[model samples]
Target: MEQELFTAQDLEELQRRGISLEEATQQVEDIRQGFPYLEILASASLEDGIISNEPSQEERYMSLWERYLERKDASVYKMVPASGAASRMFKMLFSFLDADYSEPRTEAERRFFDELHHFAFYELLNEACLRNHWKSIPKLLAQGDYKAVVETLLLPKGLGYGSKPKGLLLFHRYDKVERTALEEHFVEGALYARDSLGQVHLHFTISPEHQRDFESLVARVKDCYEEHYSVRYLVSFSQQEPATDTLALTPEGGLFRREDGSLLFRPGGHGSLIRNLNALDADIVFIKNIDNVVLDLYKGPTVMYKKYLGGVLVAIRDQVFGYLRQLDKGKVSHSQLEEMSAFMRDAFGIRLPEVLDDESLAPWLREKLNRPIRVCGMVRNEGEPGGGPFVIRETDGSSSLQILESSQINMADEGQRQFFEAGQYFNPVDLVCSLRDWQGKPFDLERYVNPKTAFIAHKSQVGRELLALERPGLWNGAMHDWNTAFVEVPLETFNPVKEVNDLLRPEHQA
Candidate 1:
């Protein structure tokens, strides 16, 4: 059967649902043009399972200690995507402009401002406002409604900041020596890798507009690492043009339409980066938020855990490759097949072994034992951030381990509530994979991705208060059918700088 294309009626229906005629027409055109690459990506699969359990708890600890004694070497890669604007931080600037020193702010207002000042960009704002001589600490409350002033003097040129990328926001404690979030993350990556793994590859994904700043930051990182181990930097950007108007949908189940009649949808989420990641083609990839990095004093345990995690992944990949080669030679015997299937079901955490309904394997790995693949987390001191690990039973009667995202768990469910309270385990910044096999066959991403699960994000708008946006994240939305496993790493490995105050912590200051 052929797939149906959008028809004239579809356009009419879209317009009735709130899309402008122009946007409806454009959507129709885009549908006709088709996204071939996306379609291909949506169709790939990973049938062969990943390697099953390897070292036990005792064995792993002993192995790591032994490896440390031998000075085992590993490479570290850190990817920081610095493309988002600092829109949230703008709220503080507004508060500053609207302050009134004469009457004094109420406790509530003062508390809010203090919290806002904690952002990483606060210092940058202070410096920019100071440089422009925009009234040294003007009495915000006494100022006659600075709304107009803000619009006219600030927003038009990127809020009085450099008007460059938000990643370029400067933080200088003394003299001219300054640092941006970009520099901080790069240094963190370099330090962690050097102290733990002995070598590191730090890459930043930036937009074309910020190329110069990105290059400058790279140079600074190189200089800092000159006395330490080797460090390499790779920079790349999406060729797609930036959107002018923010895409949004209307409240009446209608697409937000412009006077020009263009239909609107929120910019597709970060999962769009999966294509960019595929492009990197590195042997190993470490994905971390641009703002998340540990400072010097706290670098030891974090680097150690990163290497251990990477080492485990490398070892698993080696085992998977070896198994695939065995499977390629003639028909796998019943005993061998049973062992492989058992490993997949028990250790790799695969859930759909019976999907093929091969009678030959039914007697071995039972259906009820099948579960969704997941990475088990073991968190050490410092604890873990983000979501904790939990057993997830899919609708298909199989269950696997998964990381928690506030949006995914049903708050109303008693079982989910219990799991949440129990605090099963922390993610510990480690992952499982079947990306490549022993025979070097690329694991098909489409086959493993769970199309049914997703999360919707609520975003704040300039005029419109809040809007919902849907996008896929790596943990819940990015994984596939390949059996997965989880291992624990030290909690010190996950130092993340979510706010500016975080830089004041002993780790970052070092």
Candidate 2:
């Protein structure tokens, strides 16, 4: 009977992972009941949840951010999610690696080989091929040994790029050198995240296996970037907590077990990085994906918009903190309370239910004001695959801004489907977040997570199909209960290298 759920060793393993018995029980229950579809009230637009500032307002916010950066005590840091292997980026190449045909077959495969030398990593891959196989790429092509070239780039005997993280892969070409996605992030951090102390702090969530490689890469380039930009670098790294790993379930919704009768667990997705973000002591935390960095020529707009978003955050935080202090001192008037409510509605996209009671207003304002605030940059929807910002009505009859994924929505519903399709803006995961309260205390970010927002995904391991659980996404349910704002940003500020071909785009080619 005990073995039906957990054995003694299983219990010990759960404890070691920091997962409580109650949490495990709840996860099993979730697999059984399934997560509820998010109710979409409407898609966030320029006239809805999104804020599109005028040229003058944009300038003012940029100036405010510059002034805020000049404050001696201000702290800002950039957080990048860079954990996963780059296996997906090499999906086509992997197919070629296993195919019966030795030469390139498909158009994609042909393009890869035809333009192989155009890649920033061309020289490196060529050198790896020669070093590992005693034949250069040109010689291999002359011999019609295309697989040899790919194997040299991907296999352990050579560059081993197929198993490497995207952050370490060469992405952009400069006149003097090639840069990885990680190095580009350092440049961007120096441009915008540097404080009055001339220090740029950055944290990356990376796979434990690649931590040393990432550290070495940073060590190799940190000094050069620091000297080039005249700024000090404070870099840090973290791995996903084993405790946040979710159990894999069988098709029958039972606990999945390996051949050794041990349970299978998978990483809990980017949402788990909330724990890493929570651990930072920064006042302003900028969250961006590791693969979203662009070439130096295209960084100006991205840097400007980053500062603009941060400026908006500081300006809003100042007003909210002042109102919270007034509420703390019991000096707030009825008119001031109304003004606060208006600010929440207009600035935060929070539509509260009608409340006439004066006593209840102070605590309510304090509760809302004391939470974390994030200004997410939304771009014009160009059919990119990511969560789109939406305004959803909560259980309390209030409505708040949220980033909802397709899996979370009931696409079967005509109205919800229409709203989803009608969305004009897209979430770029471009966020400028404030994690401190008015009293200068760090918020317990876990408290704001919406547990019901976890995802159930179908996956296969070793030819066995299973249902994997993913925690609420970092920008979606993890920050669900926080005050949210969406500001319109340029499309140029949102180039993400989702595919290897994307690197060939003009933005990355310099």
Candidate 3:
């Protein structure tokens, strides 16, 4: 009776995870009550929220960013979400292992086997095959033992890539060496995110299980990259806190439990990385996905555009900071307030609900300008599957630019679906974010998160159906209240390796 719904053991587990029993119980209640769909105003396009810069403006913005870097006043860091396992990349091959036939049956299977030699991991996998079956990949294939080669490549007897993170998997090939996705991030950080002090700080949000592997890989390769790039690299890692783990629901819509009778929790998705990002001691932080790396030949556009986005933020951030400071003086004229309002609308796509007196406007200016800001890279939709930029009406009656995923939108509403279909740009998770406010104080990022943006997902555990909650997405709900800006980036700058075969794409190949 004292514990009520939970046993004393359950309370102990909650304490171990830094989660309160009330929070845990409320999670179950929230899952049952469900999160409401966002109120949509319209899609963010070049005509409104998104900034479509001209080709000639590129030099100006890039130069502005270069000057910001040379100023050496603000520090920059890069945050990558790399904890995801590479199992999904090999989903097709996993099916092959269980199929009735030994030989390639599907077109994807044939393509994978045909292009196997072109993969960066080919030679290493071949060595693994030899060690496991006493035969090379070619010999194994000739002998009609494709599964054996796959087992050697995937299982512990070989590279163990099946259990490894994408960051550790070899993704690109060179004349003399191969580089993993993590290594590519090092190169990219040096190219764009480096500060004038010749330092580049990168933080990876990874799984605890993979920490030792990451450390070993970094120790073996960090020095070489630092020497080659002529810059010191400060690499760090953090596991998603167990406190951020959300409770899962059983198929029947009750609190889910494991076979051993312990409560079940799942990672709160990338949104949980916000806590990790908040811990960075940087003024500017670049966020990108781990699987978005490309060969050096294709990195020029990415590097250049990254600078351009940073420059855009630098210019806007300077203006916002200046306004915030001016408002602190409390003597801004009506004309000055009008200009501030115009800039807010033009630069940030924020519109106040109604007119206010100068006394009220000053505080409004300070409130709006003093917040975390992110310049997200939006690309032509090209019919990609991901969140897109939109202008959503806020609770305060103002409309702010946002990136909404399908799960966040109410597609059943015709008007909302029309707005959804109207969006032409896609969020590539390429962002240059300002982490500190005008007074040089870090923002308590959690204060800006829109909890209503959290998502419910269907999942399975040991043959039982379950529901998992993905905290408001990192780019979507987590940053919902931040000052948002969208910039168009090139389609070429958006290559992602969703599948293992995607490595065969020209962007991934050298």
TM-score: model 3 vs. ground truth:
0.97
The parts of candidate 3 lying over 4 Å away from their true place are 1-3
On the 0 to 100 scale, the lDDT of residue 503 in model 3 is 98
Off by over 4 Å in 1: 1-77, 89-130, 134-167, 170-178, 188-200, 207-212, 219-228, 239-248, 330-342, 351-386, 426-434, 444-447, 457-469, 480-483
Per-model lDDT: 0.47, 0.90, 0.90
RMSD of each: 8.7, 1.4, 1.4
Candidate 2 global TM-score: 0.97
The CA lDDT at 152 in model 2 is 86
In candidate 2, stretches whose alpha carbon ends up further than 4 angstroms from where it belongs are 1-4, 354-356
lDDT of 3: 0.90
